[model samples]
Target: MAGAVTTVTTLSNEARPKHLTEPRPVRYLLIAVALLFIGIVVVLPMLTVLLEAFRKGWSAYIEALKDPDAMAALRLTLITALIAVPLNTIFGVAAAWAITKFKFRGKNLLVTLIDLPFAVSPVISGLVYILLFGAQGFFGPWLMDHDMKIVFATPGIVLATMFVTFPFVARELLPLMEAQGVQDEEAAVSLGSKGWRTFFKVTLPNIKWGLLYGIILCNARAMGEFGAVSVVSGHIRGETNTLPLHIEILYNEYQYTSSFAVASLLMLLAIITLVIKGLIEGKLARSRHGQ
Candidate 1:
């Protein structure tokens, strides 16, 4: 048996194409190139943000964060994420469940719509809201008559955010839930579990990791979004400026140190998000292996 196994292994190795079976030196070269590319493109920029942020000193960094306008921007960003993330999470789970676990007409169209945000630019996403709610827009007169503001306001900001970050959770859950299929769900139903109970007890537990992963990515994008928010923000400093907008304002006004300082916060957020994502991925891999 051992001899047969060895022979098969050797034959499989020999059967691999030369290019597919990379030599030691070639593998090392490829790894080195990848590392170099990542260092220059990602690592270096992050380090620069940190270095420039602290260039003036720690006191300046703290002061930059403490500025009233910066504080407000932070608040608005948090509020936006708080509103957008949960709504998207619900929508994502529902959309994924519908598409993967059931047969329905226009399912392909629904899937395409979920990917619309990714295909469209963020700026365009924001502009879409403006066109729908701006002073001269179709609903502009109605909104004005009712004394309501949607464009260039917090509501508009949230709407634009929801539109752009729409795909993350659904995109993540779709493949995962599809791969999982409905066997477990059908089994749960057979065992006397009702619809919601089956979902909460079986479906949720199964897709929890992927769902969390998607939420993290969604939150990151929601917080980091600039283009769409920028168009509808009206640049109203404390009222509508998000962190990204605040950073741009500071930078354009020649406040390099403060701009980088604000940028550091975003950098830190991105780093934390990446760390959490990695941890979740590791846990997910372990869970799948165990299963």
Candidate 2:
């Protein structure tokens, strides 16, 4: 009887609404629209950056990159990202564990605070730090009295990057950790495993992909942060200027090729970010199905 029913179901499946690989007319229309939008919105700008960078030829592009200020800006950007990404990654993990593993008062409020950076403008993020640390500002006198400079220095830049990228890892991990449940962790505890050991051995493995996804996001934002970094960097030549600020300085100096060349580095970063995000997301999807 089961075989007979299966044969009947297979016979019904042999009928086609459309070919197995084919889309309906509506689907085709949607696919075309999506492609066209991507072309206009994403592809076009990227092409423009590449074109502008090489427009004045290889010598110009090389020269642009070789500029002392440009080199310094590039270094500063990388340094900021290195500092910000790790700190944020640790924070993200701790926040996710705390919020997802424990039942506590004001949990919702804590989650909202984690998302504060995403909701606030990057410009505002930078400005808030400046208000607190800028000369003639809140802590300005004390900081100056102690000869500590943050408002327009490396520390300020790092702080701004941190503020903007703060949410990425936590946001990425929260839902995933929640979905993963705490059963394994609880069991690990019952077996005499310590908290740190359980986290490193069990929780970390389960959430590795999500955590990496968040780290990538955090790194990208830290490197590309503009509005906030701009507000705080003070554009002091090589000393305080990050890449985005360097690009602005070049543009203002009428070094169009140099500006675009520097800008192209950021564009490449964005592309790499998208590619990595896609790969991680694919892995995540596969793992979900495997489970």
Candidate 3:
């Protein structure tokens, strides 16, 4: 029994310490560093904005919210997101379907082209639109001759946003569709269902959550877009201004409090989007389990 106890003790001593007892200091150091970084970078900046937004009291907050230009900017931002997100969602779904469900020549080339915008800078994208629609651009004179306006306008803003957000939904949907496979689609077709019917009934159900998630991402990007919008937008107040652009103008004019107020609103929107995305992913999980 003494020998047995000695052998067991020897084996236990030979084993390295488990995680709970091993290097407690290192774990605490890592956690301290992470907390310090979060406090300095994220928490401090957010608190500053919150304080600025409410500095003049609740009445000032209400006044800023009710400002006509602010209201208009908010409305325009929502409208542009509404239009752009849907268009991109449709394009994304179709592009994903073609890329994943079909085998064709130049397939790789086409996908590379579709993902091109992601590699390109937003400023470059804005420049491309300017070259296409600006006064001295290729189509500029012709468009002007017809009394058309694109640059420095709402249409230009939407187009720029759409360009930037084009990849979101397609990128999201492609993997999901590819993984789900063509078996269900083949089975549907075999049963005499038409292509569109099969897609809506069989394919869409499986990828709906993913599609919604992409749309949410697209919407957020559209609403918060600044660099490209600033390039094309003349920054016309209440006319062509988006919320982000409005915030920029406010800051440039030294209205720091108002700037952070609008920024806080946008931050709230971003948080809401995250919440929605979480809900969507949860629903998707439940759906897969149900299947």
On lDDT, the leading prediction is 1
Considering lDDT, which of the candidate structures 1 and 2 is the better prediction for this target? 1
In terms of lDDT, the poorest run of 10 residues in model 1 is: 1-10
Tell me the alpha-carbon RMSD of every candidate: 7.7, 8.4, 10.5
Cα error, residue 12 of model 2, in Å, equals 22
Q: Candidate 2: list runs displaced more than 4 Å.
A: 1-28
Model 3, residue 18: C-alpha shift (Å): 2.4
Off by over 4 Å in 1: 1-27, 288-291
lDDT of each: 0.90, 0.86, 0.84
- Clash list (residue pairs), candidate 1: none
Error of 3 at 118 (Å): 1.7
List, residue by residue over 105-216, the lDDT tens digit for candidate 3. 9988887777887777789878889999999999999999999999999899999999888888887787678778799999999999998999999999889988888888
Kindly report the root-mean-square deviation of model 2 from the true structure over all alpha carbons.
8.4
* RMSD in Å for model 3: 10.5
- Candidate 3 segments exceeding 4 Å error: 1-22, 285-291
Tens-place lDDT per residue, model 1, 112-218, is 87888888888899999999999999899999999999988999999999999898888888877887889999999999999999999999999899899889989
Predicted structure 2, TM vs. truth: 0.90
lDDT of 3 at 263: 87
